[model samples]
Target: MADNLTKYREKRDLKKTAVPSGGASVKSSNGRRFAIQKHDSTRLHYDLRLELDGVFKSCAATKGPSLDPQDKRLAVEVEDQPLDYGDFEGTIPKELYGGGTVLLWDRGYWEPELNKSPEQALAKATSSSLLEGTGCTVFVLVRMRGNEDEKRTNCS
Candidate 1:
């Protein structure tokens, strides 16, 4: 039930910003895709996006991903960005909503370790290790709420 970038478009001025307006630039791969963007906004943080139903479910990882396995990171769920956002690497004007340097840290397809669809898994938030490998790197994304504490793991 993706909103097709309705909320994403509302916050951005398509005519003034360089961010990709939701279009047909969706990933052509067979598996679901994911992206990690290192954003230097008012503050620096990592944004993680998982593609499902043609839109990316986005979140801000406060401390980025952890490798200690014992550490739990805080990820705040944000708006759904267009799937094409996976390839975006640029600087949004300071006057823009997410004004900052956005670097495409990583991008690849992922496999879900769930019994249901990704959209359903996200809504249920029941998967401990939501996603498997992003190319060769393996990471975990525990379902997160708007401002809730979520755990992410990187074992690459």
Candidate 2:
């Protein structure tokens, strides 16, 4: 199932770029971790990454994440990234792939609010909220910018 990383690997030339060349041997952590990267590439955007099953599943939020529950952010799912990417902060050559500066915006961990397996809880949340009927529902509780306290937000 982890074969999903093909797109990510294909887009990056590990030898040409300073980006870490992650291998399958990277040990998976038991506890979940998440990070948001401030990517200044073709456009400026905040990339949210949630650690699940070793690789970090990704999403791109154009205007950054919000602390208010009333503010719904549109987080479009992207490809799974290498776990070590959570710590990456550097500049890709203008001619290279990403071709811009990458900053580690925020880092933290999260727990499922409904006390079930993450997948189950998410599925339950989506079904109960009817977000699944529209599209995939992604729930994350994290420390966004300027927020000392963590807030849970649903990204559908």
- Model 1: per-residue lDDT, tens digit, 22-91? 8755537787888889899988999888887788878787687665677877777688899888889999
Worst 10 residues of 1 by lDDT: 147-156
Q: What would the TM-scores of all predictions be?
A: 0.82, 0.72
Q: Per-model C-alpha lDDT, please?
A: 0.74, 0.66
Q: For every model in order, what is the number of clashing pairs?
A: 0, 0
lDDT of 2 by residue, 9-118 (tens): 88998888877666646555556777788899888888877776667778777777555567766666677798888888999887887889999877766455554665
Q: Tell me how far the alpha carbon of residue 56 in candidate 1 is from the true structure, in angstroms, after superposition.
A: 0.6
lDDT of 1 at 110: 66
Poorest 10 consecutive residues by lDDT, candidate 2: 127-136
TM-score computed on alpha carbons, candidate 2: 0.72
